[model samples]
Target chain A: MKIRIFVTLKNGVLDPQGKAIHHALESLDFKGVNDVRAGKLIELDVDDGTSDSDIEKMCEKLLANTVIENFEIERPTDQAAREA
Target chain B: MKIRIFVTLKNGVLDPQGKAIHHALESLDFKGVNDVRAGKLIELDVDDGTSDSDIEKMCEKLLANTVIENFEIERPTDQAAREA
Candidate 1:
């Protein structure tokens, strides 16, 4: 299975990277961008039988820093097609 | 409007970060893992009128390194409900 994990900063956390991107966009003359938040996308190719709890455990153990970040896991349906 | 940009390393690229994560997972005793790839997620809160072409330009010029990275843009429908 191909699993995708998105780890984003908590709402109140300061994101310097996002601010840098926003500033760079302005410097490039791009307008109307109100806010920007940067996060991580980790794609894992695991065995088909990998359980959801195991994946969540992976996240809790290593993939995410639960203190200031939140993560969401997605199992894309297209993975089956890709593997076929 | 809210737009999500997923930036990932292209195939054949050497991702030390992903390798490190995979190694760490192994260290944590997680099994059945095949591969891991790390990427970036950038969330943009832009004006409702921001054009898709404009967003694409942002990716091409600054958000992604076209030579080694691929980026996908998604406009989540839930943004409407979130803004409500």
Candidate 2:
């Protein structure tokens, strides 16, 4: 089975890369753009029996640096409904 | 309102960086780890009434380079309900 973890900075954290991209977008004449925050997405193909807690542990231990970011998990079954 | 865009390589795309990370994990003595795919996550704070269509336009035009990756969008409302 596959599990996806999305790691993002908490709201108050500063994201320099995100800011640079935001500035570049404005310079390119794209209006209506507001603020930008950047983070990482990590996809894993695990054994089918991987537990939810194991996935969480993976995020905490490897997929994310929780000191600066938060993570969300998504399963393929949930993603399928969203595909529509 | 907030819109989050996740950008990931489509299947069949080679992700050397992800492979490197996977190998690193194994070297670190973490067993049972299979493969890794790395991607980007972008978060945007927008006007309270931004439409789904506009958020999608942002993904296609700015948040992702569709030539190499695909993107998915998540609205705060949807996210909240999922939190439960």
Q: Give the TM-score of candidate 1.
A: 0.92
Clashing pairs in 2: none
Instruction: Please identify model 1 stretches exceeding 4 Å from their true place.
Output: A78-84, B78-84
C-alpha-based local distance difference test score of model 2: 0.80
lDDT of 2 by residue, A1-84 (tens): 777788999878889999987887677665566788899988888777777887787778777788988998998776655553
CAPRI-style class, candidate 2: medium
| DockQ score for candidate 2 | 0.54
User: Residue B82's C-alpha lDDT in candidate 1?
Assistant: 27
Candidate 2, residue A3: the lDDT equals: 72
C-alpha lDDT score of every prediction, in listed order: 0.91, 0.80
Q: Give lDDT tens digits, candidate 1, residues A1-84.
A: 789998999999999999999999999999999999999999999999999899999999899999999998877553333233
Task: Summarize candidate 1's per-residue lDDT along B35-73 as a digit string, tens digits.
Answer: 999999999999999999999999999999999999988
lDDT of 1 at A11: 95
Q: Which candidate number has the best lDDT?
A: 1
